[model samples]
Target: MAGIFVYAETKEGEFRKATGEILSRCRGVADATGEPLVAVVVGPAPEDAPRRLAPFGADLVLHVEGPGLEVYTSQGYAWAVTSCLAGRQPAALFFGNTPLARDLAPRVAERMDAALHADCTGLAWEDGRFVFTRPLYGGKLLARAVSRPGHPVLATFRPNSLGVAEVAATSPAYERVQVEVPAGSVASVVKETIRQVAGRVSLQEAEIIVSGGRGVGGPEGFRVIEELADVLGAAVGASRAAVDAGWISYDHQVGQTGKAVSPNLYIACGISGAIQHLAGMSSARCIVAINKDPDAYIFKVADYGIVGDLFQVVPALTAELREMLVRA
Candidate 1:
């Protein structure tokens, strides 16, 4: 029987939020196609890994473990995943559009000779085929694609587009798949790993974001943005102008050149909302802008606008949020 396969990505032996998001979304596709949902997890199998996936609608969890597989090596992972798909012959394979997936998906697709789509934002069924919607030209246009019948479909989706899955009452069956890394398959060895932000939520996976721009003044000005972000449990972001001025790191930048995000709530502080900046965040479910210029371009996309100094407004808002949380 044909099935829908999902790659369950993990970090530090724990499942990433993207794993549950993709699994939940694939479960719906599997139901529509009348196919079983299968999830393949690679790395050192944590004791609870299989259990964690069952609730997300995994009919079977393939736990792939082996030496040199503990850390992410593109060749090793691709080989293992391709081996699992050899016999099952899934109708479609889903992956989160993450750094790891970007590297591994292409290799697996080449091995399976399957059609590949990247950074998809939506999925649907039409004429017995799966339709994948993805952004192009830096999100200026959206393109839809479908795979030919008799060939397995492969695609990766952006984070946060599909919400996390609710837990199911029944548990999924577990299977162990062992991998043997062929000679010359793994060319690089990871001697060390440097993690960024020990436990902070990844920017792409954040449900809410608080961003700043040149009007934030300087490096010290980000303290205000951070304060508000901490209060709201949101990730911090900056406009390209702020990064260009050396006020913040490039990783915090949000624009066409930076990471694209679609959070539930996006609060822009002192940002002028250049088209480049807007491209990265225009998909936000709700936007609130704070700028001294009432005619700022940001107001065009903002659901709510506040004309004032962010310095004063941010502090006051943070204070109110803290008080409300305490009262609750």
Candidate 2:
């Protein structure tokens, strides 16, 4: 039987949601092609990744133990992954379309000279070949790409392209592989690995997010956004303008230069949507936009919209939601 390799990502000794999603997707690919799903998690052996990958359908967990690998480096990670691929030569390789994957996938593809596809929304096996569906022309069109003339066809899937990882059978077997990572200078030197700043959240992982932009007025105005987020049990996000205005942290900024998110619900307050910002979050399941301008681009994608002053609309919305929750 063929095999499909998955790069299970981890942070602070825990598996990221992307890892679970990739493993789940690979389960389908494995069942369809009758290939075993092999997950390679490069980090310390004591990490929680091996245990985490099991329920998602990993048949064999390749634990690549190495020094300083707990911290991510493009060169080190690619070397370790490609080296493992050299031995297994799987039918295809899958990764999450995150910043790390964005940085690492292309490097591995270049090393393996394998066919590569990015931002895939759907994946399937057709005619004994791997086919991928991805958005093109700024989400205006969808294009299909097939692994043309390649072994170990490489694909990176967008986060939230698949749903939450469901429960499965327990305790898949794990194999620890000792890999000697050749030293390199390209690794990201860690000046500091601080957690989330005083305000703002990891938009990519949030279930709900309240984002603010220039229309938010000022740094003080973000307080209202935070209050709304608190009431909704949501995270706080920001537009580039808000970050540029020093109203919020850069990590919370949602745009091309910032994080891409696909939350269950995304609420944009006082933001005039830019293409870059929309590109990051257009995939959200539901969106609510509040802005004074009736012609704001954010309204285009919003599931619900309020064409009124955000200052007035947001407080009223928050108060109403709070009262409704209390009543319930």
> Number of the top candidate by lDDT?
1
Estimated TM-score for each candidate: 0.93, 0.90
Predicted model with the maximum TM-score = 1
Pairs of colliding residues, candidate 1? none
Backbone clashes, candidate 2: 0
| CA lDDT for candidate 1 | 0.85
RMSD of 2: 2.4
Q: By summed lDDT, which 10 consecutive residues of candidate 2 come out lowest?
A: 196-205
Off by over 4 Å in 2: 45-48, 165-167, 184-188, 198-201, 323-328
Error of 1 at 253 (Å): 2.4
